[model samples]
Target: MSWLRALKATARSGLTVERRRLEPLVAARAALGLALVVGATLALFGPGAAISSAFGAFQAAIATFQRSWRPRPTLALASGASLAVSTFLGYVTGAGTHPGPFLALLAVWTFLSGLAWAAGPTIGIIASSNVAMMLVTVTLPTSVAAAAGHAAMIAVGGVVQAALVVLLPVRRWGAQRDALADALAAEADYARRLRQDPVAPFDPVPLMTARSAAAVTPRQARSRPAELHGARGLAERIRPVLASLADPAVGAPAEGPQRDRVRELLAAAASVLDAAAHAIRHGEPVDLPPGAVAALRTPDTVAILDGPPRRAAVRLAALLDDVVETAEPRTETRTPTPTETRTQTPTAAGAQTRTQTASQSQSQPKSRARPTLLRLAPVVAARMRAELRPDSPVFRHAVRVTAVTTAGYVLGSALPLGHGYWAPMASVMVMRPDFSQTYSRSVARFGGTLVGVALATAVVEVADPGVYASASLAVACAFGMYLLMRTGYAVSQVCVAAYVVFLLGMGGSAWTQTVYERVVLTLLGGVLAMLAYAVYPAWETPRLRGRLADWLVTDGRYAASVVAHYANPAGHVCADVREALLDTRAARIAWQEALDRATHEPVRHRGLSRAAADDAGHALAQFGRVAMLMEAHLPERGAPPVPAAATLAEALRRSTERGGKAVRERRVPEWDELRETVANSGPLMTDPLLRKGAGLLLDALDDLSESLAPPTDRA
Candidate 1:
């Protein structure tokens, strides 16, 4: 019953659709790609070639529809090339006389391809396509000449799929822009909550998700639109200021024009942020309310504001100025000199000017010039080196996949089961780098295959579909597979299984026997994948401590950098601050990922209880808010540094180092001594607002320390 409930929950969550607009587009592209390949093959080489080409086309279409946030044409070409090469190799090996050498070759290919997962989703999908192609190719019997021809046909199929991608490039920047808008909207909501209640607990999920979406390689950042960069930077700058403004001790003058003016300013700032978000999302002009800009510059506004509120106003002004700059285009104009006007007739002068303009345009660099592989060499090298390490999960998973697939292949061949390659293919699909995904996928694949086999068998028995009807069924299933691939593994697998069954039926296989063989072989492969994981798993709990420690260290560095900026406010340190922030964001992302993986694992594999883990996560989130507040209030030029700023900085670094060690050692550190030091440090600076902000920081740090301590008693 528990298992049934879990399955039901999984289906419900997986089937829930967001972004409905994109689904039909994806499904259409996939179906069209398949249709083109089948149609071309049937016209050029007849029905037999069409049947073979349909298999290649289905694989290519799957690769095409694998959604990536950053879509690159080069990635599509590379995927096609990989599928071609892998299919050729599989055909050659299967045609050989000896089974031992063929198995050895398969193992080596599986291991090498599995390592590609570390490079990211695009490369991972290409690798998976290679494996899928190989599984199908090895089942066919062909001579070397026939194999080469088939490989060329398969390459053509991939090219057609890639062409479809290039022809329709909708929503290229939609995901990135939407993410930035959501971040700004979240910040605006946070500000509103602060205005309503100064002590509301902040939820960091939206900001974190946005940051994750905004993260890109240096190469990507350089190529992205200037407006997007400005929006993200401005949103990050606004967050910390909002946190500072929420401090209750930052008081406004009571019952006066000043109080009313400050309240109005805060409201205006929030509205401006919301407007900026809307402008960015919709690509429309950002126009501030009539008096909003004038209000910021008014005498009353400056007179009433001080400390945190003043700082907030300054940041808000800067953000609005940036919005205006990005929204307006700049054009340079020049006047003709007296000598130039006198030297020629009007027509001659106009022609000369046109020639100069054309020459200048010709000299300018082209933005669309192809990105050289030389530029990517270093990144590829670094990823390869990282995955080569013995302790890397990618390396371990590669080895595990190689071993499992090899054993499955050997077992299938020894048994008298028809279509033995299905067993290894199942194993290939189910295995993943993480334990939880591998387990979940194994279950989903098996269950979905069973359901799919039953449906396919029933349809074939009732209709007795000929080649044309079977081909139509295959194409429809291909479309459905790509549509639900991202939405749910189980549902996608159902489509995949049905498509394969129809594809085989088109090649004149007995429907009932083919279905029986597929069900048995898939079940065997799934069980093998699960067993492999159980024997050698990459459990997340053991790595969680290290991930948490890494986050602490990076957060400490970011906090330290912010404090140092106050001591030497004149120094130009924006680059250093930005780098530190990026590092902190990266570390936070890693910690969150590790925690999520741990949550999915069984209790026996988890080092900490779920409740304890949740408590620690909450503590870390609170600490992040305090860090943002400290960063928000860096001293301006000629402004005096808080007297206790240096002391607080030192304490923060020491406490973070201590906390990291405690996590690494899996034991509690003594926080009483640090608590006493912070309590006795006294009034934290001259400005009442800075003092209050420091007090909040100390309280957050204390909470973090307490959370790191072990529970007093466990059941």
Candidate 2:
């Protein structure tokens, strides 16, 4: 009955959570996305059919590798450099050759293409750019014409996408910014909540889910550049929000009432947010600090009122007042420096005794050293092997996605007015881990394409490519824009688009006719690619949830083990727990990105979410109680001994280890002798050394538990 009730409750809660939070974003994206798709398609069909065909082919190739590529800084640079080198080498070698060996170029292209496939789009672009430059410089007439055709098609697509973004009714910027901000707030809130309630079923699953949704899309991190009008304002806003996370305290200070008061206030603030989120949908009144609501309404509240509560109104007043008013870490002043240095008397006799003590302490601590990573190595390796090998289904799927996308682009290149270009660009944007990622990519792609198109049009109108000097200047502007890669992807697309137009005009050959043709091809490729992504998306939600679960379980177990041994004395239990906690935390962080990808896969995500919640709740409960127990066991003069706790501690340790092994491996070990040994060990605290050892172990245990039980995921 209890289990049944729990299931029902979880299901009900999931529905409410999805409805109140995720649904709106989905709705908004869908509506705006449709418009973008239709507009881009129509624009492309109106221009040069051949240009559109080539543009589509390029997008298809990019789409094939879309799953592997990202706009990450290092990846971009590496890809760009590779492309530049390849282009120079290919051009120099092939320029004098008879049409160059198609197979050799294909082989080199394949290898570089594979790297682009593995590394991502930025690298692929570098390779593509090189291919363009090489063809133009190498093969006299036919090859150069083909290279120009490819470049022109790509630029057209860029312009069209950018135009769609600007003209469409979409809150693209707001969505991206909101996603990042929410993630930060969620981290703080989860930490605070878990710290206070420990056992109230703390689950990082929801937090992971939220994060996966947010991370699938990223905005440009740079501040305003010369061309971007309001980019500086956005950067300024984000910077302050990040800055607010810095801790006011520099170091650990003397424990006092002020510290206690501060803890109380922070706990209070967390509770208020939880209550608000819980109540808002139910139409119930939620209580908060006096100024929380008013604070949420202010611009300053952006940093605080994010995450689950979904309001900045309450955060500004709470944080500024709380953080500013809290007393700083107190400094401890000793007597004179000379006296402090001399306090550790090292007379010959004393030195010998001290050496013996140090050796003993070291030995004791060493017994507790259990390398957790080593224990889990087999499991991790096995999982990785399964996921990455040739036989793995996911790998096969990735290959298929790439092949299909590439085929589309190649076919599109044969078309007339470049109306096929939109299909390929869409393929690149939509081929992510989930719908959210697809949406984000689509939005960015659309915006970038449109901007590129507009820029190209403006340049052509001004320069009128019949004049070689004017056309050259236009090309230079496009190249300059490409160099400003630090700007948002959207802006960079515009620059590249304009450059495409210059290249298409064939250096003052003809301008007006080419601009329209370029736009048409790009739009054609983008549309086709988008269709592929929408039809069969692979989500990232499940894996993210799994990571959260592991962290929670590891943290909880460590806390329990630490507290159990601390309360009793003279056992290796606390040390073991601490080791386990450390291992779990490390593992949890490593798997975070994988888990985020899983969040998009609904079927797998549900299972991961459940596990994450269960583990987190257990961890919070264990850590909370352990923290309390540690505080209770604080050193004092002549405190009463905990009777018979030593025997209990040993028994618990044996039981825990046996049970843990069973849980992890599904096998029971022979434990008759271990149980007897635990039974024989009695009254541990009676020995002074044992008592001291227990006290020493407390610090490590606490640190491990806290580290494992972090409130939010940090990547």
**Cα lDDT computed for each candidate against the true fold:** 0.66, 0.37
Model 2 TM-score is 0.42
lDDT of 2 by residue, 255-351 (tens): 4432332233344444433443332223233334444333222332232222212111122222322221111111253111111122322333334
**Highest-lDDT candidate:** 1
Runs in model 1 lying further than 4 Å from the true structure: 1-22, 46-57, 64-67, 94-96, 197-229, 249-275, 284-305, 324-378, 570-573, 605-607, 641-651, 671-694, 713-715
In terms of TM-score, the best-performing candidate is 1
RMSD of each: 9.0, 16.9
Q: Judged by lDDT against the true structure, how good is candidate 1? A: 0.66
